[model samples]
Target: MTIRLASIEDHAALAGIFLSVRRSTFVWEDPASFQLDDFASATEGELIHVAETAENGIVGFISLWEPEQFVHHLFIANGHRGKGIGRALLDDLARRQPGPFRLKCVAGNSVALSFYKRSGWAQIGEGETDGRPYLLMELSKTDESTLSSPST
Candidate 1:
């Protein structure tokens, strides 16, 4: 798989992944609320990177709110989780922005929380969004080990 900046051509695939993942993963939310076009609205003005494979095409994407080094979203397609695609996308982002990056993971997403912990992100705080609780996570400036290399 290769990670690169998303193009206009990649938008449809990105939207699909975003919609499907949110619908499947966020059980606490009304799945019907996540629309394909939600991806474009949510990620507007952010820097986006996509993971693509020769066979599977676009499998995942990560978007960053650059000014604050905030990670706005990271979603992998339904069949593509736990395959290092998320980490690869993050590493690619670090290589590009060299961030002390931050993101908010829904409190109910234990799977995602585990992934973030394994990736050297820590729970720096807590907050609520859209009436749902979330854990504020951060990868500190010193936590660069996972950002070291690109995975295949």
Candidate 2:
């Protein structure tokens, strides 16, 4: 797979992945509440990167609020998880932006929480959104150093 900045042509596919992944992963949320247009709104004014494969075209995406070095979204297409697509998108972003980045993960999503933790993000705080609790995570400048170093 290859990772690159998302083009306007990639939006439709990225939106589909966003909608589908959220619908499937956030089981507690009403799937019908997720709309294709939600992608445009959520990612507006942000920098987005997409993961593409020769066969799948676009399999995943990540969006960052560059002004704050905040990662707003990261989703892999269903059937494409566990393939390192998400990590590649993240590593690409880190290489390009060199972030002390922050993001929020829904507290109920254990899999995602674990992924972030294993990714060198630490829980710095917590907050609620739409009445649901979420963990506030950050990859600090200190933590970022380790992301690039060889794991012994």
Candidate 3:
């Protein structure tokens, strides 16, 4: 898979990938909440990266709000998970920023919680948003060693 900056032409495809992955993963939520227009509007001006395949076009994407040092979104298409695309996108971001990174995972989403923990992210806090419980996680640049270490 090839990872690169997302272009204007990639917006629609990225939106589709975002919607599909989110709908499947967050099955407990209403799918209508993941709207394409809202995604397009919210992601505007963010540092968005896309993971693509020569044959499949764009398969996954990661969007970061550099100013806030937060990851606003990271989604890999349903059929494309477990292929290292998520890690590749994250590693690319880590290399670019080399600083503290933060993201939130829904409380019941064990898959996401596990991935973040395994990637060296520590749960820093917990709270509820939109009536759903979530965990706030962070990974520091000084903790790079844990990035490559096995998940405890």
- Number of the predicted model whose TM-score against the real structure is largest: 1
- TM-scores of all models? 0.93, 0.92, 0.89
Instruction: Please say which candidate is ahead in lDDT: 1 or 2.
Output: 1
lDDT of 2: 0.85
* Best first by TM-score, ranked: 1, 2, 3
Better of 1 and 3 by lDDT: 1
The pairs that clash in candidate 1 are none
Clash count in backbone of candidate 3: 0
lDDT of 3 by residue, 1-152 (tens): 77889999998898788777777778888887888677788787789989888899988889998898889898898888898878878887777786689998899999998988877789999999989999999978544553432211
Number of clashing residue pairs, candidate 2: 0
Q: Which stretches of candidate 3 lie over 4 Å from their true place?
A: 142-152
Cα lDDT, model 2, residue 25: 90
Candidate 1 achieves a global lDDT of 0.88
Clashing residue pairs in candidate 2 are none
| Best-performing candidate as measured by lDDT | 1
The residue-level lDDT of candidate 1 at 18 comes to 91
lDDT to native, each model = 0.88, 0.85, 0.82
